[model samples]
Target: MGWYGQVKTNRQLQVRCNYLNGTVNKYLRPIGGITIVADIEQMKISEYIDRAVIPLPKAEGTDYRASTITPPFGPRFNAAPPKPRGQTGFKLDGNVVSWANWKFHLAFDARVGPVISLASIYDAKKKSYRQVMYRSYISELFVLYQDPTEGWYRTMLFDSGEFGLGNFAVSLEPLNDCPSGAVFVDGYYAASDGKPVQVQDAMCIFERHSGDVMWRHSDVEREIRETRPDISIVVRMVSTVANYDYILDWEFKPSGSIKFLIGLTGVLQVKAVPYTNTDQIKEEVYGTLVAGNTIGISHDHFLTYHLDLDIDGDANSFMKTRLITKRVKDKNIPRKSYWNVEHEIAKTESDAKIQIGLNPPELLVVNPNKETKLGNNVGYRLVPGSAARPLLTIDDFPQIRAAFTNNNVWVTPYNKSEKWAGGRFVDRSRGDDTLAVWTEKNRRIENKDIVMWYTVGFHHVTCQEDFPVMPTLSVGFELKPTNFFEYSPVLKTVPPQHLSWANCTK
Candidate 1:
């Protein structure tokens, strides 16, 4: 039912059956042309629509479970892995974890899965642990599919707020979901009935040793080289929201950088159609036809995070450094124009609102009172990668409620109630309490305890390859030291000692 001017206004749940019919993937088989609209409050069906008789998706080759495959899939590695290392590399006491130069408390939220609180990094120069971010977690995400049809238009979803991330946390597979040496953590959250429900292996902590170098230099002139192995600790959780799996990782690096990594992989919410090839369709499909009788729905994912960066202390300001092009005053220089940084310390909440991907400025959350040895303000830069802005018009219902995606970045005074980017009451929300509405106050945030919000957007245009199950499409952003350290923190650090060399056997 179209929700524009009032077609069906009652609280409703449109039911679509996906019952497994002979080994077919439930998601791949959305029983089309039949929708059951039931008003739970009234406890009756408002409408039972059966418009057309659409052929069901084939039952062949639709099952993805390994056990269902005809030939067994072999193990990832041919040979057994090496023995475990002598050290576990991280210390865990209850919910608190200490790894590398980082120490933080890990807790689970009913709405947001894993919460990293009191996150501080050790400072060798200060001989103590200094606060970087007090607490950080993904607040909400808007998964909006681009289909104007009566059955598909209402697919706009607030993943975390409507369906709690903690509620969807699935137990991770060993050695597959995580490495051999990873430590698993259990999660618990309150159910609707107020009883605590526990999810085992809900999260994992592992030290990633990818071959990528952390730091390396080759001084051929002096015939010398220095290199450090890239070793970082990752706290990971996977939230399966019906048809999508969002793998979230909080990676802490030894080089004083923190990365928020998200990988999207799962079955696409495909629409069943009559066409098998592109040439057969004459009208707007709204998506690509990856399989016979299937149209992969085009969609957008906006993942917004809440970062309460203490930055050595609570009183911090967000800075935007715009690179401005200036012409040479004197025609003495060979270059006609040169660019230099023009810094602006955000005085109010509105001043910090930024739409990324358009001459994006260098973003930094800095403590003005704290300085380095060279008298530079201490700060951590927001290194945005693959940013996105909403493409939908402002009047759209989804855009109105999820107006937080209007800007890639926003800073607001830290408020306990303002944690949810989309209003806390997201189910059937009317955009009255969104971050976009809260910032309308234009409150003063300079030198105040503030929280920074960042949105990572993925504008997915459905393609042939993304049809069945999507291979991981990953995107991430980093928080790196700016002028916080006088020098590279790892410059003077000793390289990790290798315990042994490979032995040549007879």
Candidate 2:
């Protein structure tokens, strides 16, 4: 047995032998499973160590054959017919995409992979294109493994900075990673020798329908029924960083909502363990032993985003609209309590540092000069998806390297030098040039051109199902129009209907 958890004891099993040029040493045993002697001279283990004594987990009668497992016998389970071919509803003009009055220019960066810029939506009443987001892209990815050994302590990987995400992007497989009717786009990145290299089919764009209804209502009294189907245009890219593959999708809905999602699916980084059964273990293991000799360690993934929202124009303000509970002060009123909305504008950079709370506030970027038909400020709401906060404290080594994850959200005055959240070159950075450092000046941000940074975090705990290859785990965020549009953007639209087998037979 080998060292399992964080223990101070030096109980290790290393069988050193003079085989194959005398450099063979294998620590194949766990200390918790077997007993060891205090003094090495007292035990005669040196005699057996003359030859290589390390053995495989399967050779020791432990069953770790994941590929040989068979499924249970059952009847045929085909329950539905083949889906009909889907038609495209969006138009592509070079890199600019247009669908349902939504237009955006898609560009690729060597580090960030996909960049969306010049995003605008058409207004039905005004019949003009209104600006929403000027530019947006993934700022950085902080990945750290939780092993403190000599070989595993410094295993920190920055997917974007260390190795260019666009450079390592592989051609997506049709009908597998993306749909059959996707439009593939090429990308380019600079080589180490300062020459530009082309990446073929680095991104795919397509329209998706998930059989979901956007809105529907039925009024039996008035004999009126209405329904609207949900449809979206998606831009996807998958970047394989070492052993992990990250799939990023940007979904644009007709209702003026942009959803940014990231999915992780790949092999787990496993370490060698010795124990085969739980009863044989006396001490605690830091990670779960999925196989007989393999232990998958815990880890965390934090993806920070750079968003420059031009709600109506370049000049905008950040505000937190909170729902506060109020007590009825008038004794004549029968109601005891009520709720009211409170908006607080962020005047300085420090005022915009937000930690997600149980009672979260709505983060909005509004143009102070513009107003909607209802006299409300034109704005877009920053809606967070299923995410977790970075659990590491600020002083930790890993946290120091990625200080941008200190807050879930941060707003700063727009600067061209402040693109990457971690730094420009994050291979072995010392945390000097980070987003947290720039926000320390506490510059004025009220009604000024600003950038909003948000981090989507994940805390992973390995299980048996994550052995050979892990299933995809997803996290995302959304930018939805609150009062930027006068009313429902998809109110006056007609969608196509699908004919079922029963309906076609009749």
Candidate 3:
């Protein structure tokens, strides 16, 4: 039964059978539907016996199918011929990439998919390559559906762990998925039976020019103009986990920035509805009615990333440059107010835990010992993209199990056993070995070899456009150079020449 705006609204029916006990007992059957009537702190289960279980209308009806009887008949149509463009600029020496004075080793992992190692950038002033991040990868992703029905109550899925990421990688669609001139890489993994299988073209590497200026200077007095075009190399991989497809990209910039991006697309897992139109629904439905008898449920996606940043050979400290409004204290000025910067150095694990807000402080990981030419600490600032913190309450079961998502950012001293945010085997894990459990020790992180963990999430509210298939939803974060460089890294790089602008007549 659907929720009718009741306080105890979750209607999760428990389907009891012999399959759960690993025995075939024909006498076993379902007892009753269990409804969660309590708050998120203490979930109280109540048996719902009066409601009748009825089969919903199927979506294969004629009104729901796309019609081919229109004037534009369904047939193959030619769009344009493929103009082959050759690859240049980037040179790959067997999994090692060397571009823009940045060198790193990219390897495919069976669980995490792509693990980047030995990332370093060439420092012009030092005349040597400086180590940035030693290794970084996506730790885990926890997705939970909003529906409180028995079928979806325990829908907490550990996508990367439960099903190996490399096992689900699909072949790239040459020009459609990735741009032309992209180099494809194959992935190999072991199956459940211990037999090795390979997926061809599982990842693609390419360089793209978005026509953005990296740096610009125009001196009217000197009659000189200079501008450098922005160019980047992206390592792309797509994995299909059951009904949803995830597109992950590791983008490298010439300006010394590493961007981690994720895109969610694919068919939606919809529920069968009974109403055909708005007039048929007397009460509020829990989801959106995409078709005649289909309801796309609401859900949330939370992804945790493990970053082992070694800025100038580890021994780094986390600092928060907080900006606060300051009223003018000078009587001579007669001004109203201004903002002031207050620097806060994190001394402990608890001090480093961050909860993002409208105007959060500038988070930076810096080596206090290493100074730039300006005498400032060499560091990299974390720039977040479109992301959300987990909305699930801290005391909830799924929240406790995935406690790493409680805060937006967390820094801890490097520990080998603390890889997965939800523990090693998270198929149906409890809250025992989670990140929250590890942070309880309150270890010191200041000026130590530390690891940073950030959670990026999205609270999805279903709409009509997300009916049968959903458009790609992307969210990510970037690690950009901050005082680590005395000036722009691409200041001396050459810029591409612009071509003649085309008119309508061609």
Candidate 4:
């Protein structure tokens, strides 16, 4: 019902009648119909005021709950480190010496069994010296790829008993006793006795779905010839690393698209940026507004591409295809400011033209001079989202520094500290952790230049089951925090919500 009509005829009828009589000089004094005219302005004003003053029910806070969020996905259960399965031991007989943390007690037939090399290093903490070694297996076979997605590539490591790099050992042993002109098949290494060694483990074949063994390499070639009419294979050895290992990187360019993939295993740590007293610029520049021991963070932005193919012939005559994309750009600030493009198109065998162009993006300032400092020589500390006001003294600087230097913070070898991955202090004579080497030839660590390096992997404690192929793994890097916000510096300002709502009501 209409508000005015409902008010006059219903529960408020008495109030409305009193209001009308007061404005009309009591109905008794009303003149004849033609001469009487009522004033209605005061009654309308009273009704408006009553409606405006009515109270609204408050919103319920308890029901406005948020759902629990989960962390990024990782392995369901951690696998224990692997144990050696072969009958091999260290022999300290010649210039080719080897070592291991554990004692070597086994022997193997020289012709068919794998040779082991051990190198020793004194461990002050353990109050003893230990030996480290490397054991490898070699083979040739066909590997298959099931999923060819951009970031996720699934391939089977076939033709070996265990076809992946595991936590083995590594050492530089001399190869003096190897046959002068004989060609080594695959898993070949030198022993501490200066003699050549070969791995004897049989090749392993894998089932596509369950990751189980379907056939051994000894039986696969025969079975495939009898069943499938056409097949292709490549010659490569399946090997493992010892205590320390580096990632095997490859740049794939298919149809003018480039994609870089890094396979990981072994011990790895995250990289950190360091801000020291020396990084401060003496001149007052737009972005060089250093406050105290603090300096600004910087970043490099660039683009890369990826490709996929659909082939239908032998390795030589197969058709090729690809996709282009910008994998990631330098992110100095919270929000990302870049674009991505992808496509899929095929090309005839003769028409294939693939190239890679690794171009650097235009350099731009991220954050202007902001207050920053090295927190206890562990990590870079900064007041992000705004410029830190000028600090008057050293005490004031440390106060701001203490707030960000708690646990879970770390320093890495990225900038001047890049001389060592664990940071420059580990093996340097200066005893200063921040000491870095400046050289033009070293791409990973340069002096005073800002760069990002991130290390990723699992911390493994040794166990029996991981003796073979370790699981596939990966980690990532991020542009460190900087003031190079893409838009205006005041973008963080909050607007007046209540004032805007009131204006809308008026």
**Which candidate tops lDDT?**
1
lDDT computed for candidate 3: 0.76
| Predicted structure 2, TM vs. truth | 0.83
Q: Compute the lDDT of residue 441 as modeled in candidate 1.
A: 95
Better model by lDDT: candidate 1 vs candidate 2? 1
User: Which tens-of-lDDT digit does each residue in 1-506 have in candidate 2?
Assistant: 22223334232333321112211112212222222223244544422212222233332322224454356644556534433333466778888999887899999888999999999988888899999999998888888777765435655667777776776787887667877567788888888899998878889888877779988889999999999888888999999886678999988888899999999987666555556676666765557776676566788888899999998899999999998999999999999999899999999999999988788899999999899878999999999875577776677766776889889999999999999998886755667789999999999999999999999888878887875567798889999999888888888878676666665766
**Every model's TM-score:** 0.95, 0.83, 0.84, 0.18
- Predicted model with the maximum TM-score: 1
Candidate 1: tens digits of C-alpha lDDT, residues 1-506: 22343534667777677758775568888777776888878999887878887777766766777777776665556533643532368999999999878999999887999999998988888889999989999999789999888677878888999898889999998777888688899899989999999999999998888768888999999999999888899999999999999999999988889999999998899888888788999989788887888888889999999999999999999999999999988878787888999999999988999988668899999999998888889999999977778999989888888899999999999999898999878877777788999999999888889999999998999887775678899999999989887778777667777656456342
Tens-place lDDT digits, model 4, residues 340-424: 4332211221122222123212111111122124221111111111112112232332212111111111111123223221222
Which window of ten consecutive residues has the lowest lDDT sum in model 2? 22-31
Is 1 or 3 the stronger prediction by lDDT? 1
> Which should have the higher TM-score, number 1 or number 4?
1
- Where does model 1 exceed 4 Å of error? 1-9, 71-87, 499-506
**Each model's C-alpha lDDT?**
0.86, 0.77, 0.76, 0.22
lDDT of 3 by residue, 220-303 (tens): 999999878888888889988866889999888988999999999875655555667878888656577766665666788888
CA RMSD of each candidate after superposition = 2.3, 8.2, 7.8, 34.9
lDDT at 196, model 2: 91
